[model samples]
Target: MNPIDPQHRNDWLLRAEPVEGVERIEAFFQAKAYAMHRHDTYAIGRTLAGVQSFNYRRSTTHSLPGQTMVLHPDEPHDGHAGTGEGFRYRMIYVQPALFQEVLGGRALPFIEGGVTGDPRLWAATDALLQQISQGLDPFEQGDALAELAHALAAVAGTAPARSTGDFASVRRAREYLDAQCHQAVSLESLELAVGRDRWSLSRDFRVFYGTSPYRYLTQRRLDAARAMMLRGVALAQVAASAGFTDQSHMTRHFTKTFGIAPARWLRILNGARATEILRNTAA
Candidate 1:
């Protein structure tokens, strides 16, 4: 796709290359950008210009530039431009697993109202929310995630984990699932591999990871499929390779997880890449 025309009042989204446990996007919208959808990742961001509005948690909220928006996992929400002038924003979708690592099994933070003007959060997100072209090194990213996680916990008034669950066994189970996501995995198999009862494991996994075991496994598969798609792989091939039953099965899950079809997702990504190349050439 050609680089978006600045004068055209069309919506455009630019996605950064996915980093571990995080995805970043910068976008501008003249009208509605998304339908009501939920995903199992923390949607944290800042509105850079205009009025960024969304219907979240049964109410509509508007965010102005310099405000922080924090939407918890699996929260139903839809986004659009609040005013005639439209909206522009940058966002990072962080897997709950990364926050779990920092909180060590504490409940994920909840920033009521979906947006904040908290100075701590504004500062915490600074490093990770830089220009999409200015990517962070691994160490920098880790530090930023940690800082953001702590800031969220503090803001939400959530205490650190009290060392209640079998954190070690849960970690092992998570690692096993990560490695074996491409294959059929059963509760029995997970039990044998992690040396824990299925019920206990299930309980502890949710306590530590903020999601169920099945969800974590499915997300791993989805992550693989996304990477494959980015490489211009055929959808059918990607489906089979990523452990889905078939193309339709993968497409269903992909759309449910992302709120957009796989093909449209690829187009947006390609458009972003094209825009980046054009910018580099002009520079």
Candidate 2:
């Protein structure tokens, strides 16, 4: 299959490609590339050229070449080119579940500023962040994930002891949220199911899972909506089936969560697909 080139008129090209089943993207943007949004997975990447800048953790951060940007899961952030010449980069999104598996029941590591110059981190993520196009074997992938997790923990320093958290209660709550993500879920219902009070459960969930239950549910629905939308589902039907109240409701949340409205997101994907088709035909 031929790779897609971004639209000629647009000042950016979004490469819709994945490496070893993990969503990996290569892109360049002349100016603002994203609006305020958050993802349910970790956005880990390196800036290749020019100045890469973003608002993270309530401050403006910049990444030049040879620096890694590690945005934690569910953290709100936005990106753009920091200079007139524009910026280019490659990024990989890894699900929190992968880190959870390796870290066991501990809280996910947080790398402050969303940008890091730690050599250890760069070394740990070397294989996974390679610029070449290649697939990773299962064994190699597992090893790299493990190394990356440990390196992250090391950089973040010890997290103090896991205090003020009930592992069992949080786990139960998370499981319930995952199961009923497609329906309306109330804090009262979550309390009853998890056998814990609402506020305590909420606190525990935030510490363990990194976000509020409601936000997590909204992201999950958005996740489902995105899948269906990419498969060519109509926006209205996609919103309804994904448990959103209506099309506008979904669009609002989609833009808030992903930085792009559903229609715009679809257009970008379609553009990439069309470019790929043309390239393959020419080849």
Candidate 3:
């Protein structure tokens, strides 16, 4: 079957147990059937086979074997098969909290166009993803998570000017931010909390974390909103609970980041006749 349009490609999600902080998903794509939906976790995946098409940022993107699709958290996106064979992919949803465990509060790395061939990224990711797709020892999962953190850092971070992975200062800042994610955070307060100057901590955060403090906070909010919408929350309530200013504000960023409106997410999650709505639309 020929793939359908981007607007309605994502009408379903088959969820699996979350690995580490990531929610694992194995999506069976119609020639093209996933609609736009962004998640709080970093969306990383390798297409098992077929040509997977997605509209991301402002472009229609495609992924093939050996190409790592790095969809930064909080961006809007959707997926489906662009060819007759259809597409299958496994996704690992990594939380910013886990990524922060490595890099602190810095800006998360954004690999352009949702793809990369950096050896560092490839090496760091291959194993963890493999284990999630298959089976692994519990102790091994722990070790892989730690290595994955460092590997992600190596690929995403700049060479630190000081060249030291200063632990105490960065960790303190992370602890404070995590504890206060629900509260307004300030530079001066973070400086005191981390025992480093604001600029240094912020710099290190970007270097290690792959995203900035504010963006991290927004990701957390989006993550929360995603869960709520999946459970049938009203837009106004989801906005408030997810820490947005209002429904309109949430809608703007929600569609911008996830490629679908709250109503659609709620409707889909409720299993409200989507198979029918998209039956003719499915490839």
The model with the greatest TM-score is: 1
Sort order, TM-score high to low? 1, 2, 3
**Tens-digit lDDT string for candidate 3 (1-283):** 2343455455444454454556665555555454676555578877766687888899988888777888876577887677876676667777766766555544456677887667776667776567332665556656766676666556676343344655457666767776776556778787777778777776665555545566666666776787877667877998887778888988877775656666765565445245544664785
Tens digit per residue, CA lDDT, model 1, 1-283: 1232357466677888888878899888888877777777889998888888999999999998879999988788888888887788899999888988898778778899999999999999999998888887889999999999999999899876766788889899999999999998998999999999999999888776766898778878998998999888999999999999999999888877777788887886687678778879999
Highest lDDT, which number? 1
Q: What Cα-based lDDT does every candidate model obtain? A: 0.86, 0.78, 0.66
Candidate 1 colliding pairs: none
- In order of appearance, the predictions have TM-scores of 0.91, 0.87, 0.64
Report RMSD for candidate 2: 3.8
Please list the residue runs of candidate 3 whose C-alpha ends up more than 4 Å from where it truly belongs after superposition: 1-10, 17-20, 28-41, 54-61, 65-67, 71-81, 84-86, 96-140, 147-167, 186-192, 195-198, 269-283
RMSD of each: 3.2, 3.8, 6.5
How displaced is residue 76 in candidate 1, in Å? 2.6
The best-first sequence of candidates by lDDT reads: 1, 2, 3
How many Å off is the CA of 182 in candidate 1?
1.3
What stretches of model 1 exceed 4 Å from their correct place?
A: 1-8
